[model samples]
Target chain A: MRLGPWKIDVEYGHLALVIVIAGVTGFYLADTLQVSRNINNIILVVPLAMLLLGLCLLVVTQCIRFRKHPVQKRATQLPNHERDELEQEQSPMDLLHAFLLLLGVGALVMSYPLIGLDVATLLFMIFALLLLGVRGWLFVPIYAASFTAVVVGGASRLLPYPLPTLLF
Target chain B: MLDSSAILGAISLLGSDINIWLVIIPGLLIGLIAGSIAGVSNTMAMAICLPLTLYMDFLPAVMFLTAIFTGGGYGGAVTSILMGIPGTTSSVATTFDGYPMARKGLHNEALGLALMSSVLGVLVGYIILLFVVAPLGNWVIRLGPAEMLLVALWGLTMIAALGGKRLSRGLIAGGFGLLLGTVGMNTSGYVRGTMDIPFLLDGIPVVPAMMGMFAASQLFTLVGSQFLIKDKAARRADYRRVLSGFLSVLRYPFFQLRGTLIGVFVGAIPGVGSSVGNLIAYAQAKRTDKDPDSYGKGNPKGVMAAESANSSSEGGSMVTMLALGLPGGGGTAMLLAAFAMHNVTGGPQFINQNMDIVYTIIFGNFIQAALLLVVGLGFLAVAGNIVRVPLTILIPSVLVLALIGSFAVTGDHAGPITLFVFAGLGWLMKRYGYPVAACVVGLLLGRMVESELIRTWQISGGGELAFFLGRPVAMAFAILLVLSLLQPLIMRKFTAWRTRNRSA
Candidate 1:
């Protein structure tokens, strides 16, 4: 992308992170002020939230400047074709794996109270194992079931509070 | 300071009871197992075992509890070195370097260094406690809100130091953590940021949040990796390397001594204990070293400094419990409960009348420290095999365990919910260049800093400058904090000047 005679490679993920930080800071700062403007109440929150917002702005500025004047590598450092191959090998599949795992965990936690911890855990384990490329349907269910049994069973006995469960 | 008659009586008391000897190993084993698990803390371990102590005698009961205390101190370091997860808050600093070392296939050495440091820390802490418990207790109690506020600020200086090349990102993460920490209710009775969650009334549950940030976040990052240690040959748990790491600790006496002293003094303070002590020690070690940048990247000194301080804090916390009947942290609070169960109060009178019992406890800790050296070696040998597990199996398993552990910590749906939310936040922060450790530190100290600052303001008649000027100790800490903040710049200048002079 070109902006005012300068070429830049913008990383959307990094930019999104900065935006998220700024949004959280703004929300918290506004909420704190709404609670009260009393010095004692807002002493820690007001200053910290402002500091975070300031940092986000500074980071955004640095990101643009650094992207505009991205560091140049010597021709002898690596052949262009090899560098391209290296970048290809890195891939984005790892990210997809992470995202899937995150979703799996979220589903398990959200369903914990509704479906019971044991069933939720068993479902999460199977989903995770499959997503991570574990094979053999016979092995997967057995492994997931036994592991869930031991963990939930042990936790049920050890923990003071009862873990909501459907099956013993 | 030495009571001659009490020392002799303590020796006799130790020899008179065989039951005390019997419970020591079991207590240590129980503590070791509990502390190595991701979410289970030494306090939880003690609480679970508290009922069993009711059946034992007073001396044996205290001895058993202290044995657990001593063992749990080092046990947290196990998972910290093997995995990125810190088993307890006290081992947070340990993960900063120990985890890096493990990733580099040096798990054996890191575990050995942690074990040796913990043993010596306990020995030195107990020795110091024996001579100066009374005086230290008196001095520590004199520290008011002003001093504690300074101490919290001193720990906060670590945020800047942890920033490395990206100082602003570190600050942002830390600031975000500070704001998040004050989520539920303020000390002044004004609430903000709770989002109407009832559990937020007590503030974010720190242990569960920590489990998400460190353990679950790291597990997410490890999804596609083949193994924790990429090189198959390097994953073996070699006893020789462990021994070498053990022997290497003796060479860094200065780091060990400094960390132990910081642990003792910081641990003696009520409401602030090993969690902050280890951070302060690690920060000081990094600041003072000739090569400060090597710290977070896997410096042995970082592990040594953190472990020594956290382990030694056991004895430091004992000074308050023994001399003033005040518990410094949860572990000591459990000990206090056991004291109540046995119908023996701990105060100046208790110390004066039962001097032998006090000495007996200290001496028993000495033995426990020695036993830890042996038992800890066996435990490390078994625990070191974590590197061999493939990431396919390890990642989901650890995530599930962390989820369960978080639930155990908070005892409700809120714990799992918090863990899930923080896991996503931690992952994003890590994917960017933000320092999660800095955020964790900020969260830990946020409530403390706010409460102390409020108290200081109230005591100083609305935050008067003259009130701070009159405090010599606070002034001293302020000066030290300023100097530490400036140390990196000064060192840079000095090095540049030396290089120019040498070239000229």
Candidate 2:
């Protein structure tokens, strides 16, 4: 189940299943190879199997352990002072900012190759402006124009960019 | 003297000369950017830039990477101070108290402490590398597989030493890490775990895995908690607080020296580096303090211990790189990759033959650290304001950059996909309390150990116990490994007995 400050959230069950599948598939592949019991190879395989098994075992242990102790009950009745002290470890603002940043970065990454770097930068800038709660098309073009200047001026001079051709 | 100078002239080369000012600024700038973000490590920055270096001349490329290295070192302190999330492994211990200080609005003091510690750590580590690396390089070059194995084992055992009182978990993680590392290839021409995925033939790329483990897991945690957060902090942000905070570094050199020594020694060891060093130093500082309980509760000493020690380790790790032809830490490994690309053979005689380039590296470290101190302080003063950028645009753009950063290496979608794959696995590992970094380090050092073992085994015709343990130096290291593995167990039993006796 839960170990110390770390908990094996129920959601990781899917991941555990995936690992099990991977392990089995790996075992199957090892068998399929039809390799003889070479000492060195066995030395490698045995450890790999054990490590995977250990990971799976640990995950399973977490799920089993926490099922016996719900989060609310555990938090309220915790005997240890340290665990009690860690009750409000994460703040909402921290999580939100991280997600917003993650989402923004994810979107920009998926779109980069489709549009050229400059266009991508301009569009991402608009999206970023929106994330910052700034509404207005006025800043959009200004953002693009300023970014374009920065990109062109900066890249041509300061950056070590390779083969960044502009599509007129 | 002239002949000596000629040889020195040949070796002091850093790389193909590039625009110095342009490179350092960008390097520092990117490092600052990356370091300020949680889970984006200095190593990730290096890996992302690895492919880019193939195109540039050597020195500029090296300079750029070095800049990122310097900048990344200080950048981690920002997130550690502002948010609980460590921008790097090194900064993890800082979160014990740094974030609490920020929450109390002593943000300037905490930030200042972090900056000072970082600069001091860097200065000390660099100085050590300058004096120690060249002298020891000759002897270290003679370290065979046996010695290297001992060194690797030393790194492996650090988990047990620093894992708080939970020594069993640390040992289990470390042992399991070694096992995970055993996947894929062996020195005897056997590919045990390949199973047809050609990508795994070379074993797992620890960098991508590390990113997944450390970076992606944090992302998943962020995602899981999404939509529950409210926007606060409508008050005006101040830059002066950031400046006065940085000025405090000059005021506290003792903290710097203590932290630096701890960091450098930890860093010099082959496998471990800033994170472990930082944690150990912080804990030690706490244990020795008059008010030990003050730690993990907004103590300035906590921040000083962690930040200074973490930065100091960077220099120690470099010493291993220069003297022993060993990569000190993950960052040094990246440096090694760059050296390899430049045909820079850095074994025992490297410095003797090429003092200029060698000295340049040492001097470059000082210059890099000096520049990073200024850069980090300046950014810490202003980076808080960066939060206002719209998520919509910044998200998509950064995503592109991250993807490009990944793909730029292998030149395929595989790299980005690999990044995500690592991220997904990392998420699972974190949720289940699996030792993420331990597994990665195990995997990273695994192949190297096996390769050497097999080489040594074959070299000695079946690796007889006598041949393996024959050399005195080799025997010494092997003895160290045995003791390292046993010490924790002995200490635990001794403590338990003492407690029981006292109870009786």
Candidate 2 per-residue lDDT, tens place, A41-155, comes to 5544455555556645564554443444445646656666557345544466544654564555455445555665566556666665565455677976786558655653454
Chain B TM for prediction 2: 0.70
Model 2 iRMS (Å) reads 6.2
Q: Model 1: residues >4 Å from true position, as ranges?
A: A66-91, B488-504
Per-residue CA lDDT of model 2 for B1-504, tens digit only, reads 123563355344534343644577778878877776544578778887888888866666777887888788878887666655566767767776786676566666777678767876887787776667755444555666667666666655654444333444455445555655655656676765555777666666554455445555444453322111124352124557656666766665666678788887766666556655776577567655767557667888878888889888878777777666788666888888988898886666775676666666666667777777677766865865433443334433334334444544444434555566555555555544454555555655677666666566666677678886678887876776667557657766877999999999
Per-model TM values vs. the true structure: 0.95, 0.67
Model 2 root mean square deviation, Cα atoms = 7.6
Query: Which predicted model would earn the best TM-score?
Result: 1
Tens digits of per-residue lDDT, candidate 1, B1-504, equal 989999999999999999989999988888898888888988899999999999999889999999888888898999998887888888889998898889888888999999999999999999999999999989988888999888777766665556435667766877777778888788999888887889998898888888888876578777777888988988998999999889879999999999999999899988778877998899889878988767776799999999999999999999999999999899999999999999999988899898989999999999999999999988887899989988887788888898999999989988898888888888877777587777777777788888998899899999899999999889888887677556666777989999999999
